[model samples]
Target: MDNMFVLGIMVVGAFLIQSALGFFQIKHFGNEYNELKAEGRVAIGKRAGKLTSGTIIMFLLDDEGVIVRGKKLQGTTILARFKPYDKFKGKYIGAITAEDSEMIAEIKITRNTVMNAVNNYKMFINGEAIPEKGSPFAELVKKIKNI
Candidate 1:
């Protein structure tokens, strides 16, 4: 009983730490996002790797649709935090070719994520509803809703 009690306490303590760290990480992301939003239009893209590291990319755009700045966050843990990115700065959005994407992206996943951001910006300019890409569970829920 004593051992089990100690284990339970440890688990609870770990959970609390994780939750607190996650909250702070989210706050950091929000502050960065809001800062960019204040400067200009912001386009965001995300890749969720269920078992692997995930990535999120945000681009700050000018009125002419040029990328003014960028930020990226990637990791599997809450420790992941947004960092300044400038690869696409001064470049126009929605005009990256496959070759360009390959050259610019540090990895394949980042390449796809950047493309998603470009598409997001394009759709927003056209006044189209942003299409969502969700988990398998979310798809199942949508299917059930339609029925």
Candidate 2:
């Protein structure tokens, strides 16, 4: 086989594998989000990681802004799965304060992400902008534009 042809084949294989993995990741998020939605409104926060692991948090909130359940996923690889994040469960989103210790479990979600969730929920209640994905690409673009 020609060397260039072999390289092309390898690249295609990699792309296909990546796409399949991406699909699985989306499905995983969808399944969990739907489950949480079934219970109550879901508030989400995200932290995009460049060299480190990215983090995403989903909180199931009651109509009164109390957290009923939570999930967090943090990883650099496709194998990362959402884990139960019960730290703030049963706490009111408004009541969770800076005084609360920054305790995160094995998922490695940062306190900043939790604060983002709080801000997002507040914005939601106030009918402001909806929470959006903190994509690294968009951040990079913003940085470049600011420069």
Candidate 3:
């Protein structure tokens, strides 16, 4: 009879401990969830306005679309209307050819943003950034005068 009583006490103690552990685990998970939610909110709040623009000096493959950096053009259409030296004071630094080759450009970006995302892996030649998606050759040379 004493042995049975001891077993009953032991079983109750074990269940109590297990319940306490489960409650703690739930509390920990809730804290972690709140922290993650706060971080996401902060990140969204930090992204304010548009950054700078520049020719892409390099291309780094990422989940987002191709990034290009260069002398921060003042207007919003700079990326869409990017042409060979036409926008930068009529200075045709160089041109990207259809053939696979190297190129150069005056890459630019926002003061604090990641440079790789702005440059987008496109090699700059003669102060000119070239994107592999729009052109044929992957390379070109920047004119020394344009640089």
Q: Which regions in candidate 3 have their CA more than 4 angstroms from the true location?
A: 41-147
> Which candidate ranks first by lDDT, i.e. highest?
1
- Candidate 2 lDDT, tens digit per residue, 61-132? 988988888999988988789999888988999776555764444334467778778888888888898746
- Clash pairs detected, candidate 2: none
TM-score of each: 0.84, 0.86, 0.28
lDDT of 1 by residue, 14-129 (tens): 99999999899889989999999999899998887678888899999998888898999988999988989889888888786558854464787788788889888888889999
CA lDDT of every candidate: 0.87, 0.84, 0.32
Off by over 4 Å in 1: 101-105, 133-136, 139-147
Model 3 deviation from the true structure expressed as Cα RMSD, one decimal place: 22.1
lDDT of 3 by residue, 109-133 (tens): 3222223322322233235554333
Best by TM-score: 2
Candidate order, lDDT descending: 1, 2, 3
When 1 and 3 are scored with lDDT, the better candidate is 1
After best superposition, candidate 3 residue 122: deviation in angstroms? Answer: 32
